[model samples]
Target: MSKEGRNANGIETLAAETLQRVMEHPATQNDIATVETQLGRYPRGMVAVGARCVGDGTPLVVITGPVLPGGIPFPTTMYLTSPEAVKAVSHLEADGLMRQYNEMLADDTNLRAQYERAHAAYLAFRHGLAERLNESEEHIEGISAGGMPVRVKCLHALVAQSLVMGPGVNPIGDMALERMRNEFDPTVCRCVRAQSDGQETR
Candidate 1:
């Protein structure tokens, strides 16, 4: 298959996986509440829980709608909500991992191609979500979060996409996750609050 064909197939697979996740784990009020606690505010435009903590089932990442309630365009689809995960990625960003990834992308053509494909897949996935929500994609067309295709701006955004879409979809995200393996393990529950208790106290 040609590169375009492969890209299209990748996009379709990702879109299908996202929709299936939505079907299987539809967002609940409790999930919103938990995410709000994790984020220290109510999550806006969240459509579904993209990924949950393997340890305690807390929402680790959320899938936001393409447009907000008032028709505001939101380009970020996958948002990291786990406090532990956020802190780990934030530490990596503080250590200048993004600059290293950017430098790597500048030197490696193959990596650049993969990053471009990831960007395309992100756009496709967002568009699919927009269609599902009956929202316009005009405002955020060709726009994806995390400084994809050219730069590594936000490790948190990239890592969120990686956790939601799984590894190999975003190489930079995979790298970030790998680098932070010691600090953040999704398999182990690192959530500060015990979600099972249903207590709002943090």
Candidate 2:
């Protein structure tokens, strides 16, 4: 994969082809089971475990298909499933981080361009999912999460995108993840009790 671009946070973005390869990996049964435990329910249209909590090595983010079961057009393809991660990101949101990010987008031309690329990368990932699942892109075309290409609506969505696509792919996502690292390091295992029934398989 070639280095295509860099965000304000110094995170290098992957080329569209590289992003596709990274997000197209298949999910294992154990990965799905752990995610189910995290969400307390079955995950629909999940294609891969995009990111894991280093604390417990459990799945924290999942790459879901554009269209889930029952013909539902799922817009947020990268879903955050970890309880800790969700809570941490929610805290950032509650602190007015979205407004801050949007202000950055408005003031920084470089960041806005990088964010636009992030949107493109997200669409490419979704198209890859559509190809693998034999689904059409008609419903999900041009739709990317976290207000990509224009705004930053949700840090959770942005962080999920960064986790799946990697750092520079989503500047805002990278920023969110960076902020939450101190409170919730995904590298450390923290789900010992949560995974005791079957043990951590991620």
Q: Using lDDT, give the best candidate's number.
A: 1
List the candidate 1 regions with Cα displacement exceeding 4 Å: 194-202
Tell me the tens digit of each residue's lDDT in model 2 across 60-149. 888787888899888798888887889889999999999999999999999998898888877767766678678877886898887888
Worst lDDT 10-window in candidate 2: 5-14
**Predicted structure with the largest TM-score when compared to the true one:** 1
Error of 1 at 89 (Å): 0.7
Candidate 2, lDDT over the whole model = 0.78
lDDT of each: 0.85, 0.78
